[model samples]
Target: MNIFILEDDYHQQGRMENLLYQLQEKHALSVKRLEVYSKTELLLQAVQEKGSHQLFFLDIEIKGDPLRGLEAANSIRQRDSQALIVFVTTHSEFMPLTFRYQISALDYIDKPLDKENFEARVEAAVLYAQKQNRKTVADTAFSFKSKYQQFQIPYEDIYFLETSQISHHVILYTQTERIELFTSMNEVLKQESRLHKCHRSYALNPKNVVRIDKMERIAHFPNGMTCLIARTKMKETLAKMGGEIE
Candidate 1:
């Protein structure tokens, strides 16, 4: 997991960093990297370069910035909506203030940060992010990380997977966004060639499909949700499905 921290208080930053490491060891986490940023621009640039960050820890205040940490957290979400964000603040007054950042934030932790609360929340977030990090192919194999128990998936169960225009993670279509696991579209495409990349953003698994209404540029799955098929790749998509390229 990669996490970027935007905190100005040197002493508090040190404490948070220590807790992060401790959490890693205690949870047996596979944290590949963690970054600390004093500037929002630096953090934003890093996130953009990293493609996606596993988690973001933003302090609700910056020493000199006019906007609060909540504002910065919101900005980060605009770049990657699925990125896990946790806002920490001494201002417990912002508890019901939750709605302001509810759309982007996964959780808000109050200061003086309690170890028990921190551990529980971070553990839950870490587990959820890990779940969001991977998915199984439709069928014929049982593959998954040992620590996780998501179960072997049958590819026929997959609806579709697509890359987001503004983010690094690809969205999975398992009929529900809840099944929307976050993995690189590249890895997914390479592993399962049956999934036709009908557009720059979408790759559809034909097995779970209902019908393609080409005139409307949409794919209707058995569950009733529709996905757009870009006109640019219409020929290739049809060819993959064994239909004549019109």
Candidate 2:
């Protein structure tokens, strides 16, 4: 997660930095980049080139301009509607303007910041950002065609694909469902690179695999489901998984 702070006060900036560092040390927050900008122009420039999963903490008043932070946040929302925005200011009266601007501010933190309240709001924002990241990943779908229908399943929900007993068909195993599709293993492989042929009968999604048993040559999924891993493919699969074998 990328975090951006727009605060003109030096003391407030130091306080936020300290609290964020403590959160990082305690493993309560995962931050890729932490940037502090006293100027709104610079902050907006960074927002224009922003990456995924961003969190912004803006002070409503910047250099006597009361509405500067709100304007900056509006620009951010225009660029990335999903980015998390939080207002940190003493001007509680301006809270209504957030709704008027349609910025969707995540939380409002009062200035002269309270340690306990600050930590709690920051932690909440971290959790929300993590959830949004998971949702984005889960939204990616694997598209394929069945005998009579076309299927699009979220990549995160899929466990594996195996050859069905019936000829020219394969069974797609998901977290809650199993779908029999008239597709070959070769064709399935072509659909998504994430689906690897771990065995002659099984093409498992390594991302959804909970564990790999080297001795048993089995792949365990989250839904108490299991699939075989071929001896010939075990070494290659282990390599792909960075040798995290049991």
Candidate 3:
């Protein structure tokens, strides 16, 4: 996980930096990078560039700056959905405003900082950020795009994918919904190796397979749907499920 410190006070900056050093030694965490920025613009730019799997320590009151830390957090959330944002401020009055912004902030620290509280919050945030970082690495997602809309679907959510018979169109099946996307099955298979090509027109998730009827040459999912499986590909499908043919 990476760390970004955005405090305007020189003394607070020094204190936070020291606390971070203590955290590193205490946890023995190998943080990929650390950045300290007093300027809001620089921090925002950095967040847009490498905000994934990152943690932020933002001071609520920046002297002479109208765009305070809360605004910066709102901006960061636009670019990064999973970043851990912690607000540090002198006044406790602004604490209630966090619910209004809905930034999903991790925690808030009162200035003239308490070492124990600071350490505890930082430790919790770091653990959560690192857990999310590992999930990002392991659970790769398929990104969908169109003229105006775009979203990502995690590979594990897909029960199966098949051609729609329309040019550049495919039908995606999940337990919750079916989506029509303008894409090729080859393109999708190339993106994720976990999908098994059971037939010329279909790819299946072995983990999602509830049953396979050899006589019908079909694979079943828990959603009460079945996809044709080529007779020749049965062995490979079984192998994917860690089953040995008897």
Candidate of highest TM-score: 1
- In model 3, the runs with Cα more than 4 Å from the true position are 48-52, 139-246
TM-score of each: 0.58, 0.55, 0.57
Candidate 3 per-residue lDDT, tens place, 1-246, comes to: 678999988998988788777777787877756888888788987653223367898987776664488788888876556577988777678777777888888888777556777677767777777676667646665444444333355556678989997998878887776877667888777766778999988998888898888777888898799899898899888888788422
Clashes of 3: 0
User: What are the per-residue Cα lDDT tens digits for candidate 2 across 1-246?
Assistant: 678999999999998888777767776666667889999999988653322367899999999999999999999887665678989898999999999999999899887566787778877776777677656545676656434444555677789999999988899898877777777888878867888899999998888877899899999988799999999999887876677757
Instruction: Sort all candidates by TM-score, best to worst.
Output: 1, 3, 2
Residue 142 error for model 2, in Å? 12
Per-residue lDDT of 242 in model 2: 72
Tens-place lDDT per residue, model 1, 37-99, is 887777877763221225887887787653477777777665444567887677667556547
Backbone clash count for every predicted candidate, in the order shown: 4, 0, 0
For candidate 1, what is the TM-score? 0.58
Which has the better TM-score: candidate 1, or candidate 3?
1
